[model samples]
Target chain A: MKLPSLRIYAFAYLAFLYAPILLLPIFAFNDGTIIAFPLKGFTLDWFSQMFANDTLGRAVRNSMIIAGSTAVLATAFGIFAARAGTRFSFPGKGPIMGLIMLPLVLPEIMIGGSLLLVLLAIGIELSILTVILGHVLIATPYTIAILNTAFASLDRSLEEAAYDLGEGKLSTFRLITLPLVLPGIISSMLIAFTISLDEFIIAFFLAGNEPTLPTYIFSQLRFPKQIPMIMALGTCLVLLSIILLTIAEYVRRRGLKKTGAKDTGGFL
Target chain B: MRRSTASWGFWKTLRATSRSELPKKAPRAEKWRRAMHLASFQFPLPVLSSAMLRKRAAPQETRMAQGSPLSRLKHSEAANGLALISPTALYAILLLAAPLLTILAYSFFKDGYLTVIHEVTFENYKAVWTDPIFRAILLRSLIVSGLVTLVTVALAFPIAYFLSFHVRPDRKSLWLFLITIPFWTSYLIRVFLWKVILGYNGVINSGLKSIGLIGEGQLIEDPLQMLNTVGAIAATLAHAYAPFAILPIFVALEKIDRSLLEAGQDLGESRVMTFLRVTLPLAMPGVVAAVLIVFIPTIGDYVTPELIGGGKLPMVANMIQAQLLPLDNKPMGSAIAVSAMAVVALISLAFVFANRRYLRGPK
Candidate 1:
């Protein structure tokens, strides 16, 4: 009890942060229409409703496609740039890398709004493709950030030795470098995928008539009756996101260990 | 001497003629001639164009001394570097740079009735600058976002400090991980959950009523109009950004060398004194980073205030959304977006400049 104030404050702080979100699953399962304390007996109706909705299914499908495409696209681009960045000395390296990571700090609304204008001006129809484009732009930075460590920590001597032994450059890269950084690649893909999946504003502005999951959830918010179902969906999404992030963090950490690199913090 | 000079001239003519005919000759004949020339000279020709490398290189002889294999590797490396990075560079330019510049360009144009005027003008900027409501919303958004940053960082510091200093090192990541799980959830859902919790008949009110804080069946009047207020929005925003604030500050805190704190304590400073004198100063970079990360996005946040504040307290983002979506004033929205980015850039620059000492860390 000696100066226990800090401990109590920390507990209260975490509660304040998490308690509201914890209510998401609670009220989703609650049988009552009104979201409140008196939990009407639990039921699976909201889950059923969420699964039965055709629009929700379509939105889910659209989101999955966008997220998957973004993950692959961003990670592929990330690998090349990260390899170039780590393995070679080049001009304008600082500015080039800075621009690549700029989206991490730039306001998403600006990105979404500007891209929306540009897309319209160019007469490219807004679809899940445009959403994927935007997601890839944002997700690329995260992928590169993850892959930089992967590429940087790699022992250069291994590649040099392969080359010295008369291995072709492409074959050497394929045989040695790819397998070593596979964990980083996996981590980057998962992180990029998660980022794209949870993303809203870019998808909202650019998806046009197509509904992604976040946009669908936002649209459904106007109708009070759909609240419970949205909650159920939220519950499932939160669970899935946790699992994905945990695996991603694990892979990233494992990569660091494999390369004997110091942990410089990660998603976790 | 005359015969030697004549022989040298003959050999030079032979070499020149052979070089000229080498391209037309078969590969085997060219290789045989090159091998004969090398054997006669007892040395190999430089792989790099000696004239080009020497003319460009200030340390010409040094590069020549490093020889062909390394130079060939370097040449191919430069090419490989370009080849590797070209795709991402192209993608960023086309997707990110072009659109951002377009937004900047659009801010200077006029919006027609239903279409954008191709004529470039500063009318949009002028209108956005002069409009009082727009100015007020912009200022209010900055203030609200600033407050949220302050509140979030303040709240996060204690938890981060506790986690960094008190928790077992082995379990620290677990604690950090648990705290950040909420962050991975959809931001819209998180905001909506706040709405449900703070609504007039929402969780808090219902919980209070059930405990008899309000009279039975007094549902007609709102017991607490918690929703649709700046404070509520700030609270929700702070909650949403808590993990962001915590993680950075935790990283900064954990980086503080334990020896420094021990040294401070050994010198008769209390734990609190050591933190204020040593820890706080060292962790400023993280705090600033946390501030910038939370502030910039929250200022442009349309979802939180729209959902939680119920349009009563519109942020700059709401106005931008209004102009773009319903009003169809793309130029005005573009101007607002530009102005918002400018304001954030200015504030961040100022913050960084003001805290240059702390942010730069220990010399």
Candidate 2:
């Protein structure tokens, strides 16, 4: 109450941030093509149309393949890197870790362009595989970030205790360490999947003739008649993203709790 | 007053009597009582409170303590670290590092009419540096991104402060959670939503028209042209990057030792003075981090400017995209991308240095 204006300002800020995104579902259900308002009668024609499109379905399938593969690869890579980073320090550790995290901030356009040139020059054709390659590059950093917290929070004594009890290193990892960090792995996979699923530029550049969801939406945006269907698709995507992120955030928090780690502000 | 002191004496005597029978439980009971007091406490500690430092360093200390037996652990750990990290290291080198190095190499190569000439030269870099359009777009991109960072961080600070200081401990996570829900939505769609809202016949225009701010006939003729402008881009960028700004700042604020603020106040400073002299200074690292996080990505963003800026106000990323694909100028694109990366790298370094300075207290 002492700074009532600050409270109001925060609310307004949240509203300004969320209001535009709230429009997607509104227009998706509106029985109109033009994005202008006068609240047309409600209809699900756009959603039905979106479902009936073959190209849209193929794009969705392509995106799913790319996202799934990227998630597994990135999370797997993340587990190793995070474990190493937390457990040990070596020469050039700082620089190596910095280089790995660079893609998180580096422009996707640069990575996409660079990758496209290299792949083409090397006589490799572009496809969903190339997109997955690009996605793993971007998603790996995020996975590492999440998994780093998980690995760091792990009580090292737990591992040492297992070792003290005569368990081999690999068996100790499997029996104790892996089970302890399972939540972290699941969280990392979910985050990587969400990131890869919604990724645009890399998929745009590397998909070549293949149509992913973003590229399809971008292409369809040029046609005025397809706007409603795109809106419908956007609505569904927004819902899916909310659900996925909720689960990811939940798992992340749960992992932190299980490991007795302090929350340092994750995706949620 | 006499009765209260007498009761306190009685309580102390009672505790002393019970201690003999429950020696092990005594320390834990006292610890629980102290914890409850700290939890309900509203004041803050002085700058660099050792208790806060100890609390923060608890995990690190434990990690180091577990890292004894140097000769044995080192050999095994070193080998295990190398083995464990190799897959990711190899992946980065093959996909990310190789591509980036290729781009650097390509930046020096010549682009012939049909085939890319293998001959290396400084032609592309020279073109990027000397071209007035590239310079203008680069400057514009930096300015736009700077504005976005400033606005986003400024708006996020108070929200983060409110969350850290005003919100209840139990509800803070929920508020933070709600704040990030918008982030889960596709960023491209969020940018596109801004386009819709700011379009000629879009939400803003229609709302103004319905409110009679514009004549009915003028709706089509004289709508506010907000899209494709720098202001629009900045607004959209700020909205898109709010969570990125808010979360870091909130984390920084949350980590502040509350007794520090109380110490300042106890030293005869007013509330505002205490905040200015204590709270803001401690939160600077987070603010710097938030700025860097928002600024770096926005400066290199092609999508927002492409969709919302409508190609009229192309950022450096947009120019790079044009050269790489439609313009058939990979060398030039690589040069621009590399230049942008260098600039971003320098800025990040400066931010990292600033964060250290903040942590070390202006020394």
- Please list the Cα RMSD from the true structure of every candidate, rounded to 1 decimal place: 13.1, 10.1
Docking class of 2: acceptable
Candidate closest to the true structure, highest DockQ? 1
Tell me the spans in candidate 1 whose CA falls farther than 4 Å from its real position.
A1-11, B1-82, B216-222
Every candidate's DockQ is 0.39, 0.35
**What are the clashing pairs of model 2?**
B44-B258, B44-B259, B44-B260, B45-B258, B45-B259, B45-B260
lDDT of each: 0.80, 0.80
lDDT of 2 by residue, B1-363 (tens): 111112222233233323443444446655654553353232222222223323432332344345465644544534556677889888888888899999999888899875688888998888899999998998999899989999999989999999999877767777887898787578888888888899988888877777777665654557788998999999998898898889878977887999999899999999999989999989987887788888988898988888888888999999999989999888888899998888878877877676665645322
Weakest 10 consecutive residues of candidate 2 chain B by summed lDDT: B1-10
lDDT of 1: 0.80
Stretches off by above 4 angstroms in model 2 are B1-74, B216-221, B347-356, B359-363
Q: Which candidate is the best by lDDT?
A: 1
Can you write out model 1's per-residue Cα lDDT over B77-172, one digit (the tens) per residue? 345566788899889989899999998888888888888887788888888899999889888899889999999999899888888887766677
Model 1 misses residue A35 by how many Å? Answer: 1.2
What lDDT is reached at residue B263 by model 1?
A: 98
* Model 1 per-residue lDDT at B279: 93
- Residue-level lDDT of model 1, residues A25-128, one tens digit each, is 89888999878877889899999999999999999999999999999999999998788766653444445666777787777887888899999988999999
